[model samples]
Target: MSARDSATVRIDASDTLRFNALMPGELQERARMRARPDFPWVARQAAITLSEAYRGNLLLTRLLNDRGRVALALLMLDMHFEQPDAPGLTTGRLKAEAVALDICSPGRVGAILAAFRLFGLVAPAPDLDGRRRRLVVTERLLAIHRERWRTILQSLALVLPEEGERGLHHIEDPAFLAAFVHALLEPMRAGWRPAFDVPAIAHFADRDGGMLIAFALFGTGPTGQPLSISQLARSFRISRSHVVGIVQNAAEAGLVRRVDEQGSRGPGVLPQPALTEALEAFVALVLVRQAVAVRRGLAAIGVA
Candidate 1:
């Protein structure tokens, strides 16, 4: 299979596993409910509740997919804070709490903890006595929570036309959303530098060749401006054909856009404002996927 096909297969398998892990017994029920015509209204109510909690700076909004799991996780955190003397309240303790709360099996808690830690939603740290480790909420945790909540609210408002009784007063500004998306893309963006070889793309091209092409074409260009296809090819030692193909794909995916379009003879350019909005939405979706993937990956590895 092609590299892209392989990635697709892997992602599909991962998604299936994730869905199964999240609601093993309730999938059919959930699907049935969601298929109902009034499901959007239900989702809107849930979104409003979640958004309110997020606006209040509640830490529980960080966990996606399962509300029960989030509640259990927060309860575990609270339990740690209230009963420092409680045994089995370590990372292990949180997992046990999740199980007690019927969020997941006792054996699955470790995986859940790992998933939360991977995304910076929670951090493993030494307790006050410095003897055992405990989970502490991180700033990124709150940021992700707030972002997801906003996305949920926006999605609900968009999906449920009748549910828009009032607008959120503290909705995130476009600039904030753009910055959040940029932050999430940091790893992908940093990999485009010349000095650092992106091993992740090695399956597609030679060492540093992929980075060179990506940087010139996708990375900031002349005077820190976005580069055009022809200019990118000249800098990367690649053919215009290759550069054109890559740029086209990136443009289609809403990643890169042509800056100067008046004199252009190629595909139409993406406007700055539209690109920014698309990137923000892409980042929000990615964050949710990553959170769910981490949770599932951990469970598959028997960590949870």
Candidate 2:
């Protein structure tokens, strides 16, 4: 890839949050202020925590239906204890408010509540009897979110585009992006494994991975089989160079092989059996990630 292409795939810390651009003077002042001796680490920590939570939530929403997305956001916003009147809203009241927001069915509320409790993301407040108490977010969950966001952002940065560049904006708000980063990084917490190969694919796809994968898998041949270079380019709406590059990469990875070369069109073939198996595995992985994100989003709302 050209440097422009590589730059197009880089992600930055700014991608994790949505804030107004800072004037040079203001930025310098803020940097100096952060160097102060008395600055509270807790505040900095909280900011990081919130940013990661927002990113995670965003990824979760992408995996869920509209109702699930709205429901999760409402629950998180409602559960935020920093608001002045937050102390007065009981769990039941919050649940009712979520319903009013048209986020979820009343019947599903308790299941969500139970799941959050089990995950220790939220705990019942002390006053209104445990069952009806306000929801309190746990610090551990915040830490988990932070780590997850870091991983996702790091991996995505390798594949996502740069600002003001020609590429898909996989994430908008920094907070939401951070959350997704967090979710993507979770498996790494235990230890490195082979499944982390998605990052490699992301790096390969860069800004066009989704479209590329879709075309490669579904739009290539007439009967849904692999196609020749020209056919792949036409079906995928990409340049022949790009198709050649992708195929070459797949071949290097042992994910595909040239099956025949007799036709005037050059070669005609299909994904190697190994490639097919790999694709199946990747699809399964994506599905699992989506499911996990949905569960996390629902849990955030206080649903199973």
lDDT of each: 0.41, 0.41
Residue ranges of candidate 2 with Cα displaced over 4 Å: 1-225, 259-266
At residue 256, candidate 2 shows an lDDT of 59
- Model 1 RMSD, rounded to 1 decimal: 15.5
C-alpha lDDT (0 to 100) for residue 95 of candidate 1? 63
For model 1, how does the per-residue alpha-carbon lDDT over 10-94 read when each residue is reduced to its tens digit? 2345545654564354335334445657554444344334334433232332244232344444444344334346553476666
RMSD list, candidates in order: 15.5, 18.3
Error of 2 at 129 (Å): 41
